[model samples]
Target: MTEPAAYLPVLQTGRWFAHLPPDFAQPLLAMAHLRQLAPGEVLFLRGDAPCGLYAVVRGAINISGTGGRADEARAAMLTRLEPPHWFGEISVFDNSARTHDAHAAEASTLLQIPHEPLQAWLTAHPQHWHALALLLTDKLRTAFVAIEELALLPAGQRLARRLVMMAEGYGQWTAEGQSRRVIGISQEQLSLMLAISRQTTNQILKDLEARALVRVHRGEVEILDLAALRATCY
Candidate 1:
């Protein structure tokens, strides 16, 4: 595959590739193949054989589980991954089938590194294992925090925290110094991620809007006052 000029630059921005030495990082970049997805396209499904690790180069991808249903649209979304994020590491490490479905939340670009090459690289450069471990640990810590929030936090607080996290995860400022913390997600998707009823989520969002903490639109939510939103997390 012809390497896109943007490939290396984009990979460098990701936490997954940030700590890699040039020797190891260069070879891994060479082995990656670019993959593109249209909106709502399925990248992989639960129970599907693991293909490789994926890094989101641009746009968003949704990770979800079926909740014992056949239709994917009905699946409960776990999270949305923006650029500079890597996933599918769990299945790659265990050599097991994919545990969740990954779909394009919008038109997306990805770099897929096949399992064999990744395994070989890891084996050859065992010292680099620490960086990979750090990546996995970060994911685990996020999961643990989610579990703690679900078990202990009230619904409104959980919603507040989720929005704040999303803004931090995916938001960016433009050169004009404008805080463009607009999240490209609908209320329904937020409800699924938080595991809350749509009605309850809508009410919470309406309350935030009333307080000038957020501005909700069709398929998007913009953070109006990030400091105030963070204050709600308590």
Candidate 2:
């Protein structure tokens, strides 16, 4: 048996793997390989064959699509996933090509679990199916929220909601013990995620800054007032 890598502890902390029984999760650790990715690196492109499951140990992954435009200007981001999140399961479950492209939003560390061994193990341990089902359900719920926001809310409200979600879901505590949400994304990326024009996104961000709700900097947005920011989600 292969000795677990030093980073196996980090993978064990992930929500998807943490709840599994020790007997089940231990084998997965042995099969997992750690991968380091540079900023803007493409992990896999859409339509690539399913290879395995991936969990982010550090930094972020941008899941996006490239549209039909010749210049690829019509590309849009679906979501940004940070540490303790797993992806690639959709393709693994169906044995289909990747549905979207995954890129490293920053320098990142990932754990890749190859499909063949995982599938074989899962076949023998059908009792673990519920965990996989729960994971898929959470992803679906997030998609539903994004769809509702895009269809019913104005651009400003949608942007606000996005910011709040980012802060709450991925933020960290400051040295002073304050809740500080730092979104490591550019304005253009934000606009793409929100499905709005960059100019509109900038205008809304400026408004939020003026109101002391957030501080927008190059390549990042810092949540200064999380409560007020959450209020805008309504």
Candidate 3:
């Protein structure tokens, strides 16, 4: 049997995996299958049948949606995920089709725990099901907060809050060190997530830069002061 200890260090950077019981974590990592993706590759499309749960080991996964409409705005980019975020658990519970499109925003590595094997394991250890549900609930909490931001916050404040949120890995950041300081995202991608114009995103980023709250690079934003970034949400 493969030892879970071999994989634990990297996976432990993600809060969800770190919290799993020894019995649960051991088998899950042992059963996990790996896949590599080329940049721009489609991992899964909206409406596809659920396959399994996935954890991002490296690189970014872009979660997005496409609606069949003449309107250009019908296509929306949601969030970009990096290690060691886990996703696709919603369909695992409900046995439903995928709710959004997932693509490799860059060359990416993933560890997937397939539907059948995971179900078999869960049947024997039903107590660990709560651990799985916690993953879904964490996402729900983020969604609720996002909804509130969209309705009440101005574009600038919202963008600042988003920078802070992304920097913190949407609360999945349990890793120590510099991983949390650099957010690998482009301004255009940020605009898509916020449903704002690229020009607006550029201007907002510039304003934040002027205040020394962040340093924007070609394809990333480094948080110079995460606390000040959060304060802008007001």
Candidate 4:
């Protein structure tokens, strides 16, 4: 496969790769190959031999289980990869088959690097491990927050928080410096993420819309007042 034009930003912007030793970054970049996925295409299936890491250059990919204890989307919403975000690293790190399925939620561009190449590169730069450790620590904290929300927060509050979180991750600044998102997610998707029924999701969203906290249009929800949303979560 032909190598990507540049994988540096993919790695540098990712929580996992940003701290790599400078020496390790170059070789890792060399191993990356660019690929495009159409909407609804499967990037990989669960239990497939792990190849390497995949980082999104543009668009969205949804990670979910194919077969495991729960073996369904309800079990997890593993990760949603947007531009400059990495996914599929868990499989690479463990040197095992993929534990989940990665599918394009929209037309997407990705950079995929082979695990063997990445491992060889990392071996040559032992100091890079420190950054990986820090990345994992932060991930653990994030995981804890998810667990806490599921255990203690109501479904409406959880939905509100999840929206705010996605906005933080993908919203762009407007001319007035107000953050706006172009996310095209649906009520059913939000229902799944919040572990609620579609009807409930619709009701909550309608209430938010009535309050001018958010706007719902065809296949999209725009957060109009983030402060109101933060308040809604409480």
- Write one digit per residue (lDDT tens) for candidate 1, span 4-103: 4467776665545766777867776877888999999999998998798888888999999866535634658899998777888887678899999899
Q: Which lDDT tens digits does candidate 3 get at residues 76-158?
A: 78899888899999888988999999999899988889988988899999999999999999999999999999999999999
| Higher-scoring candidate on TM-score, 3 or 4 | 3
Measured against the true structure, the TM-scores of the candidates, in listed sequence, are 0.90, 0.89, 0.93, 0.83
Candidate number of the best lDDT: 3
Question: Given candidate 3, what's the lDDT at residue 109?
Answer: 85
Off by over 4 Å in 2: 1-5, 8-14, 69-73, 170-180
Least accurate stretch of 10 residues (summed lDDT) in model 3?
1-10
Q: What is the C-alpha lDDT of each candidate?
A: 0.83, 0.81, 0.88, 0.71
Order candidates by TM-score, high to low.
3, 1, 2, 4
The C-alpha stretches of model 1 lying farther than 4 A from their native spots are 1-5, 69-74, 170-180
The candidate, 1 or 3, that scores higher on lDDT is 3
| The best candidate in terms of TM-score | 3
lDDT tens per residue, model 2, 205-224: 99999999999999999998
**In model 4, what are the clashing residue pairs, if there are any?**
none
Which ten residues in a row are the worst by lDDT in model 4?
A: 170-179
- Candidate 4 lDDT (Cα, 0 to 1): 0.71
